[model samples]
Target: MFGPEGPSLRELAVQALSSVEHGYDLLAPKFDRTPFRTSGRVLDAVARALAPLGPFDDGLDLCCGTGAGVRVLAGLCRRAAVGVDFSAGMLDVARHQVRAADGPAIGWVRGDARALPFTAAFDLVVSFGAFGHFLPRELPGLFARVHSVLRPGGRFAFPLPAPAPASDPLFWTLLGFDAVMRVRNALWWPRFVMYYRTFRLGTVSAELARAGFTTELRALPEFGRRADGSPRVRLVVATKPTTQQGS
Candidate 1:
């Protein structure tokens, strides 16, 4: 249990045994109370980093679980802010939880991220803390879908923490957790595809480039630097170029 209101062990086990969508659906109500939700620190840091580039008219929060990142989108976009996710339960919770107090008119849509139901519609898009559900092989298609939904010169942004060093205990913990997940999925019926170590920046950058994004990494200075002086976390700002190659 993470806190007084967090899901109990039995609830977590039941959800974990279910498919990814179902699991999230079951967790929707208590998701913010759990550690799985993106932290306010990260959201605030991202909002600050993105503010200069925005005054954007339209924005999308991809895989917008319970609408955490929608709060960030609302701050930057002027006219419309949309949150899209496949889990109807999650969207239902989001609809009630988030309100358009200011910034932009907010809306929630139920849809799959791999096959998003929009094209060149948004000037900006962001996702937070949901990449682990996607496998390494899915990056190309996922990035392509994000690209397709963005208007020319639109930006797809997300925060990526630096991988824990090999000597760090967190590194081994994630490695072991991923191993356990592999074994569990092998033995289970509905596989829960959440692996923390699969999305490496090198592979992700290459995939984004392949999907027609020009990628840039902006330091999230609020999180500070590591021992090596590299940023503890960096925001990946991958843009869909305004001009076509042949044009």
Candidate 2:
């Protein structure tokens, strides 16, 4: 769903046909007006979940998009907050839009998430709604990049909602969306690469472990629980080890 300020159907179709970076560039101007931007409620929930574990230093927002996650980092990190994304257009919008009045100084860098342009410079890293762009096979490298950027004992965190049950319409909707994306990728030139079903908790945890992170899951109580009494949403906090270990 989009607002009056959001991209039109024709504009969306055009974006769908373009490569991921270029598509996001085209959408950057109106990204905040669309459902694609991470919601304020979700941002607040993640911030609340991360607050206790922090007193963090510098923070990096991987694949920061229009810089929503950077806003969260600004409040939590004591030093500086940096947002990195491949899309120059998105970074431009973020530079103009996101501002921290008093907390941390904010900076923007344009770089690929797979080959992030940083070392162990960050005490915390956060990402929001950007994983679906990465294929399942890319998880290891992606996690590794996040790990590389973090200082020892640093955290890479993001919120993940519980998968919908089979009986729920949302489940089918996501399934259908993934199915359509598969077909589109198969038929199109530059694949859009957004899928709803690929990222799973079990797989992600294992990958995080392989990438040298000790992972933790903290339930976001604001979203409540499912009928089965499991959390409706969780914040995945993957911490880089304080000491070196054989990979």
Which ten contiguous residues of candidate 1 have the minimum total lDDT?
Answer: 95-104
Query: Mind giving the per-residue lDDT tens digits that candidate 2 earns over 1-247?
Result: 9888899999999999899999999999999999888999999999999999989999999899999999999999998999999999999999998886889999999999999989899999999999999999999999998999899999999999999999999999999999988898999988998997888999999999999999999999999999999999999999999989864
- Each candidate's TM vs. the true structure? 0.98, 0.97
Off by over 4 Å in 1: none
Candidate 1 vs. true structure, TM-score: 0.98
lDDT of 1 by residue, 1-247 (tens): 3997999999999998999999999999898899889999999999999999877999999999999999888889999999999998899999998899956999988999999999799999999988999999899999999999999999999999999999999999999999989999999979999999998999999999999999999999999998999999999999999998679
lDDT of 2: 0.94
In each prediction, how many residue pairs overlap at the backbone (N, C-alpha, C within less than 3 A)? 0, 0
Clashing pairs in 2: none
Candidate 2, residue 135: how far the Cα is off, in Å: 0.5
